[model samples]
Target: DQQVKQNSPSLSVQEGRISILNCDYTNSMFDYFLWYKKYPAEGPTFLISISSIKDKNEDGRFTVFLNKSAKHLSLHIVPSQPGDSAVYFCAATNRYNNNDMRFGAGTRLTVKP
Candidate 1:
C-alpha cells in the first residue's frame, strides 16, 4: 500500500518564479515530513523537513508546510532556477519507528532558464 502520493507527476516553472510540489499521505502515524531532491544519477538529497508539531518550516529559498488535518504537505521553492530542476520526493517517518520510512513516487520539477 502506498502511504504517500504525489498527485502531479511533473511541474514546470520559469526561472525566478515559485515552484510548488504537493504530497498526500494516508498513514496517520507519520510525524516527520521530509523533502528530498534527486538528480538523474545521484541519490536523493535532503532538502527540508517539518515536524507534525509545526505547520511550516523554511530554509533559505525552500519551505515545507504540513497540514495535519488534511494529511497533506507541500514544498515551495522561491526564485526557481535551472539548477533546481530535479525529481522531488516527499518522505514521511513515524517518530516511534524511525526505521520505517515512506516515500512518494516523486514529482519532477523543471525550472526553465
Candidate 2:
C-alpha cells in the first residue's frame, strides 16, 4: 500500500539557502519518521529523524518536523550546499510493530552553485 507520498518529484535551490521537502502519510499507525539522502549509485544514508512524541528534531543544519494531527512531515536543510544535492526519501514506521518501514517516492534535490 502507498501509505507515504512525496508530491514534489524534485526541488532546486541555490547554495547556502534553505531547502524544504514535504511528505504526507495516510496511516496513523506510523509513529517514527526518517529521512534518507541517496547519492547516485549509492545506498540511502540516514539524514534526520523525528518521533511522534516530539514535533521537531534538529541535527546541525538538518531538521525534521512532524505534524501528527495532519499526518504530515517535512525536512529542512539550512544553508544547503552543492554536495547536498541528491534523492531524499521520507520514511515512516510503527515502533511497536515489526520494522516494516514505508518509503515515499523520493524527491530529487538539486543545490545549485
Candidate 3:
C-alpha cells in the first residue's frame, strides 16, 4: 500500500543551507497534506501543511508546495539549523476520509554545523 512515498531515505545539509524534502502520492483522492518531523525515539511533530486547494503554504522558515497534477509535494526549510535535523514524514488524508491518514516511510535529515 504505497499511497505516499518519500524516495529519499536521508538527506545531509549544512546548518545554514536549504533543506529540500520530496514526497509523492499515488492516490489522487488525498486532499490534505502534512509534513511531520520526529527526533530519535520520539513521536512525529507537525511541521507544516497545505491543502489541495492551495499549491503553497509557508510558516517561518518552512514552506510546503504541492503539485496536484504530478501527485508530488515538497518541503523547503531555509537556513536549516541543527535542531531541524530529524526524520521527516509526509502524510496525506482525503477530505472524505479524514479519519484515515497515510504516511510515507520518512526521510532522516542531518544538518552539519
Candidate 4:
C-alpha cells in the first residue's frame, strides 16, 4: 500500500502569517520525502526534500520536518504571501525507487492579503 496521505485538503492563512501543512505515510520503506508546490494546470515544482537520515530541511521561507518513528512529515511556510496561494503536494518514496514519487491529492493553500 503506497498511500501517502495529507490529512487536510485545504488550508487558509493571512499574508505574513505561518502556514503549516501535514502529511503521513503508510509505507515503512519510504526513505525519501519531498514537497512540491503546484499551480493550476501545471506540473509541480520541487520546493523541498529530505532524506530519511535527516530530520529537517529548509529553503528560504519553507521548511520541512520529518519524523520517521511517527511516519509523519510537515511543511511550514513562513510569512506566507498572497502569491503563495497554490496547491502543495506531499510526496515520498524510497531512494531505491529512482525518485519515483507518490503524491497526496494536494492541500490548497490560500494566503489572503
Q: Against the unseen true structure, what C-alpha lDDT does each candidate score?
A: 0.96, 0.95, 0.96, 0.91
Error of 1 at 3 (Å): 0.4
Looking at model 1, residue 77 earns an lDDT score of 96
> Could you give candidate 4's per-residue lDDT for residues 1-113 as a string of tens digits?
54899979999999999999999998887899899999999988999999999999998999999999999999999989998999999998865786677888789999999
3-87 in candidate 2: lDDT tens per residue? 9999999999999999999999999989999999999999999999898999999999999999999999999999899999999
lDDT of 3: 0.96
User: What ranges in model 4 sit over 4 Å off?
Assistant: none
Residue 6 local lDDT, model 2: 98
lDDT for model 1 comes to: 0.96
Writing each residue's lDDT as its tens digit, candidate 3 over 40-73 gives: 9998999999999999999999999999999999
Q: Write the per-residue lDDT of candidate 1 for residues 1-113, one digit (tens) a residue.
A: 99999999999999999999999999999999999999998999999999999999999999899999999999999989999999999999987899899999999999998
Candidate 1 — worst ten consecutive residues by lDDT sum?
A: 94-103
Candidate 1, residue 104: lDDT: 99
Residue-level lDDT for 1 in candidate 4: 55
As for candidate 3, its clashing pairs are none
Superior by lDDT: candidate 1 or candidate 4: 1
Q: What is the TM-score of each candidate against the true structure?
A: 0.98, 0.97, 0.98, 0.94
